[model samples]
Target: MSGAARQSVSSALPRSVDVAKVAGVSQKTVSRVLNDEPYVSDEVRRRVLEAAEQLGYRLNSAARALASGRTRSIGVVTLGTALFGPASLLMGVERAVRDTGYALRVVNTMEGDTAGIAGAVESLLEQGVDGIVISEPIDEGEVPVRVDVPVLVIGAPAPFAAPHVVTAGVGAGVLASAATDHLLDLGHHTVHHLAGPQRWYAARDRLAGWRTALAARGRPQPPVVEGDWSAASGYSAGRDLAANPALTAVFAANDDMAIGLIRALTEAGRRVPDEVSVVGFDDVPVAAYITPPLTTVRQPFDAVAREGLEMLVHAIEHPLAQPSPAIDPPVELIVRASTSPPPGKPREPSGSTTSYQA
Candidate 1:
């Protein structure tokens, strides 16, 4: 075939019959050549090969997978709530699966309990998913080891007991540390932390990072104020933080809490970044538009999800591969308008002092 004619043929034909027509051979001969079925004569095989090359015909992966007894579908289980991190992670998984020409069956678990997660997995299995990716954190003692298919868990590293949990690496810790350091860099003597519930891996890692950053600077780790990953709890925590005139900078574990903290501080006549600085994690969509845009850390959700899915697919394909415990993606710091140095000094206690407002 002439170069120009071959290019035109390649652009126009994508099926075996089209290649057969171009090569002037039977479709059966083209199929034999494609499958390496040995019955074709040499001349016929050469014609089929030239035609296939010219036509740029490639075998369909779906047909191949079906014949191989492998379903090209993956199951993804995640929280139903539209929280920033989980929602973003799900999107990333969908994007990666689509890029690989695989289908995804998403199951949203309303809660993070073992029963709920297991049920979601079961539903996905009923749909014939080749592998599963669980987007919820594995509670301390709740890893599932008996599922028949390969599963990838996408939270903090579960204990050695859990078989194939892949976590977004030091990203969470890096985020927490970056927020703390930002506060410190702004001349805050110490950064107080408002942590999330201990049951969550993110909560624990963030607290550890905050403590480590503070300790490295020889600053005292303030008593932790725990919240339930809710804005209400953050608001209540903020009330107590507002009482101490010396409490200059605060690092809330998530952006919701940071939003509440800012509101509480404003109500108490404390000016953000003037009287005190505030730093938060997650860099949620609304973080930048709040009263004073929040200074926070951004998680690499796309990279994390892509890695988690790839790991699960690998595990599903090769059941005997040695298990790796965790995977962590990197994090970046985002500087906004809400964080700055502390005010002059601690104000003298007086009738103005208020106890926990909640």
Candidate 2:
């Protein structure tokens, strides 16, 4: 037969029958192969594949899902802000779902309200999602009262009371300690902190880490300035740091704040790295493009998202398995041009005593 004639015949045939006929097997065998059921021989699998290609047969995902009684869909709940970190995490979750041949159903909270979160969760459940991934970072006290399905909470530590929840393994303490250690290693006597909102777990844990590192090094803990994870708040905190000439190093909780601090320092005629060194967290996209390029801590958003989804799926498949929540992931410091030895100050001998300098 001519190629064009063959094409027309192939196009006219039904997918299931085409697969069966090409493989010289029954339609039941084709269905078994598609479903990955046990008892299918390797030779039969190869024949099925060749048949599928020859007949232009594509497995009907909907039909397959119906047979399995699963929608093969994952529900994602998030604050829905376009902030770099949250947005990147959402993309990562979507990527993981697609790669797993599952559909994604995203539900965004309205202004991070608890009611909004509860509603979003309900909606996902109503849609018959097989699992849920909560992308927002909430305090342990603020977690939803009850979720009927398996859930994975990203950003915050997993709630111990909730066995089904999994958190992004990255702990704020690790990020904070890494930043503090970097500044300390650069010969700064101590590192000051510009913190995020007190209610946030990240802010709390990071502050704790900073203090822990300072204590371990026997360095005095400086006063902390609180910001709301905004550039403006950072600018305000930066102004204070600029006035205190004794302040040599700083670690801002997030990159946005770091940018603001840098701007404030510049306006005050203090040269970054020369007069004051800065470190930040999140290592957002713009961190590298900033005037001096920020030294920062990098969060593994993609890995967190993938792990969270996988955990949720596992919980869905075996609701009684109840795995222990993982500890926060480790954070690494990325040293860059923004940090260096403090200017205009000579290092004192290790055991030397000096009069008050500030």
Candidate 3:
């Protein structure tokens, strides 16, 4: 056949019979190999897979589901917001799911969605999925869902009462505490918190971390300034905070707010690390490139997703197995030019701190 004719024939959907013809195997054997069923020798399996690849033989999901009673899919419940933290974690989950060779079904919900997480779970359950990941960081205030299958709740507490549900994404407390400690170690009296909206469990966790760190050092806790995780909100908070001479250090919940706080501080003639210092969470892509180079703690989004999804998949494959112990990802505090000893205090020796000073 001419190249055009060959391409035209290949363009049509190839069936299992085509794979069987190319593999020189019986259709039964082809089916077994494609489905990853046992009893197929390695050599035959390779041949069948190679032929399927060459023919672009895509398995029909509906047929596969009927045969195995499994959709081999995972549903993710996440907030509809495009905020950096949740969005980045969701992207990490997407990458991890693809690596697991499972189809992804994401259902986005708003904060006030009447149906809530239960509704999102129901929608995915109707379509049939082997697992589910609830990446919603916001606490929906007791919106319950009937979670029968394995569920992985990342970056938030598992809201489901299901026995198969597991949680991932360690609290931001450790990272937040490290951030506060960094500022205190720089000779700041106490660290102020520019908290994200308290409705988000992440924000609350970081807030608690800040308090924990300060309390451990016997430093007095400062009143917290709340922001909506937006630069504008941070700017507004900064403008008000700029009037306080005691505002020497701040740990903003995320990078965008930190950037805004820095801008407001600079405009008010408070030089970063000289008059005031700022630390942020999430270590956004532009954190280092910002005017003063934000000192922040990095959230291991990919690592969390990979570890969490691996645990979820394990539960899906072996429901009776003892669950893998939760592994807390290392907290990395990236010290930058935005932090230093207070103006009148002596700076630490060169290369003195053990933290990852980026």
RMSD of each: 15.8, 16.6, 14.7
User: What lDDT does model 2 reach?
Assistant: 0.73
Error (Å) of candidate 3 at residue 28 is 30
CA displacement after TM-score superposition, residue 288 of candidate 1 (Å): 1.4
- List, residue by residue over 179-289, the lDDT tens digit for candidate 3: 899888888999899999998989988998899999999999989999999999999999999999878899999999999999999999989878898898988889888
TM-score of each: 0.71, 0.72, 0.78
| Global lDDT of each candidate | 0.70, 0.73, 0.81
The RMSD (Cα, Å) of candidate 1 is 15.8
Query: Relative to the unseen true structure, what is the Cα RMSD of model 3?
Result: 14.7
> What pairs collide in candidate 2?
169-328, 169-329, 170-329
> Residue 49, candidate 2: how far off, in angstroms?
51
Name model 1 segments beyond 4 Å from true. Answer: 1-67, 138-140, 143-145, 158-167, 318-329, 344-358
| lDDT agreement of model 1 with the native | 0.70
Deviating ranges (above 4 Å) for candidate 2: 1-68, 143-145, 157-163, 320-330, 344-358
Best-to-worst ranking by TM-score: 3, 2, 1
RMSD of 2: 16.6
